[model samples]
Target: MKLQTLALFCAVSLLLFSGCGGISPKPSDETKIDKTLPIVKLTQNGVVEDMNSIAFEWNAITDERVKGIYVYKQRNNLEGSELRHYKTLENRFTTHFLDNDVIPNTSYTYSFKTFSKNAESQMSEMKIVSSLPVLQSVVWIKSIENMPRAAKIIWRPHANQKVKSYIIERKTLEEESWKRIATIDGRLNAEYIDTGLKDDYVYKYRVKVVTFDNITSTPSEIVQVVTKPLPNPVKHIVATTDLPRKIEINWEKSEAKDFARYHLYRSTSSNGSYELIAKLYNPTFTDIVEEDAKEYFYRVSVVEKNGLESIHNKISIQGITLMKPQTPSLLEAKLVNNKIEINWKNKDSRVVKYSVVKKSKTGWFDAKEEEFVDIKGLKFTDPEIGPNTTYYYKVYAIDAYGIKSKPSIEVQVKTPAGVRDNSKKEEITQDKPSRPVNKEVEVIVPTQDFN
Candidate 1:
């Protein structure tokens, strides 16, 4: 009996020691969700009414074995695919999400996953979860003008996400807030048309999650827009030039990246308002003034691509048409009959003007500038010559820029004993008109002549 008791005691000792092999087991009271928020139970709250106020609901808990819960989102269908592991917090119940800031015209599929600090519980039935958030579509706030209450907001379904609805919101820029605008149907949709707006006011727009609960998650980033009528722009301005038969216009070229064509303006007077002369595809423009006005002013303006024009730039200059003079060496005439006929001719008129003057015993006085002064045709005749008297004559030419030259050698003539002079008459050999005998003038803006 002593041996038997001894054997039984040894067996019990072995059994007790085998049972107490490793470390102590952790208690079940404490819960910890670490890397993932496991989907122990998924609850779908059904379809939403107002897309703007739509929302998704879920219940959460960190496994009792984990230290903290790590929340993650699977952008694709919440299938057992990959998840963009995002936020992690100690608490685990905040599983609701708002579909804001998503690209317009696209859908987003969202799902929740739970991670345990124990690492033994794999991604908790993410694919197996019965409930998930189906973001119908994201909408872009349409820009509006001249209406406070009414607006036209638009959006698109999330491309890569599974969308089931759309939500939009609006508020005045002055209010510093937003209100629900319209609820877009996910199945039957294109654009959300909101009408009946105030006359002139500012408005802000945003979007929200569209699900069962009106639990609007968070406001979308506001798309700023304005609604006011545009003011009128100044009218057309004209361009003209100082040179006869010439046009010149100047304008400021816009540094705007969206630059467009330019316009030229013309006006009869410097002070007078201008009129649009023509449209130039370039910044600077030139046109011929056919009428050859005595004076002209010009204006240039910028034209935007959107058909908007800026104020005109104005400038004016004096206009003159100059005819150069010729050099006449021998000029003489005397009274032959009751008619006082006179004749004159010149050398070259290299872009110059000529003035002819006469005197009655006293020295010469100023006379009128001539039109027939060029080297091409330098002759003029006043066909009324009267009888017997002495006449003195001299001539010279001026340049294109209106610089007068010195007088030519003078000649004295007498028409006496009229009938006998017929035998001694000399043939009038007219030379191809010669150019002006120019004096070397110092040029202010000198240029080198190749010749």
Candidate 2:
């Protein structure tokens, strides 16, 4: 009994020594059950930056024991149990991650979990991420002018992907197949210049982008352009005076490409100032002259569909209006047997006919009294003259060109003092002749007011 009491005392003394030594005690059951992990808030959503690539961001975890974040990805069509392990990050202080391996044009679901040395917490709120497909095509392709026989193609850079090169294709109006003309590196500006093209021909173009993985994108929208052609001057230009008081101009139609119209220019002299007279869809023009026997110069130029005019300084021609015949001369008037006889002499053989005009004393010259007289031996007999009154007469000649001649010198005559009795004077005819008087009365026809 004494030994058992000694053992009890020793046990009590050991407990007091252990209490004086300040030894740590075992954790309680409540402390052992608490296994809470870090809670993180998503600062930014997942965003696609390239083909099969996305970036993610989150707030820094507040738990000191958090080792890192664990990322999990799953197809959007699958349930939460189908999530696959994507990546694991060991950096406890890091709050972002970039996932590079994924399928393009597909949707994926993602979540993050905080892990410790001995335990893994429940994942943060689920997030959805999607990786988009590569760019389909470039944008805004167009053709700019480089030369008459060349074409310049330009386009905007592709978006949402990395491009390695560009391919340019062309096709003519009559062709249905496309031909690759150039390969431009993506590092340079999105442009290409194609040379040695046929003039006046229509062409179509399209562009395609190639990725770094050697995948080609869909072709761009089609663009159309027509090359300009050199101007072709008109041939065989002619000018003639076939009409009265006008000049007719003509030229051979140009057979060159893009023939639009013709331009006719006129000038009074060959080296003088030129004026545009007419623009004709046809090849002919008529210039109406204002004065008689005037000279005019003419030239023709070809206008192309592109508004280019051919050079015409080396070609020119001249034309003149029809010439008018001279007037008759030596007009004579005499009173015979109460009738007046008029006669004139024409020096030009071109004169085909003659006209006579008369006026009584103290009477205005009436246009109605003008008469076209047949030039029978160049003489005319006037049976309507009055007695004891004087009359003035003038004459003109008509030429073969339908042109009128100048007025002839005037002539004056008076009948006998007695009235002309119609009963006594039978109508004078060409079969009979009238006796002439010796007295000659004369007046001059003023040409200043002649039409």
Best by lDDT: 2
Error of 2 at 271 (Å): 5.2
What local lDDT does model 2 show for residue 133?
A: 73
Total clashes for model 2 = 1
What is the C-alpha local distance difference test score of each model?
Answer: 0.45, 0.72
Report clashes for each candidate as comma-separated counts.
Answer: 55, 1
Q: Judged by lDDT against the true structure, how good is candidate 2?
A: 0.72
Model 1 poorest ten-residue lDDT run: 442-451
Candidate 2's displacement at residue 19, Å, is: 64
Candidate 1 residues 232-304, lDDT tens each? 2223333443444555544444564344766666676778877887877765665654543335566555565
Per-residue lDDT, model 1, residue 379, is 35
lDDT of 1: 0.45
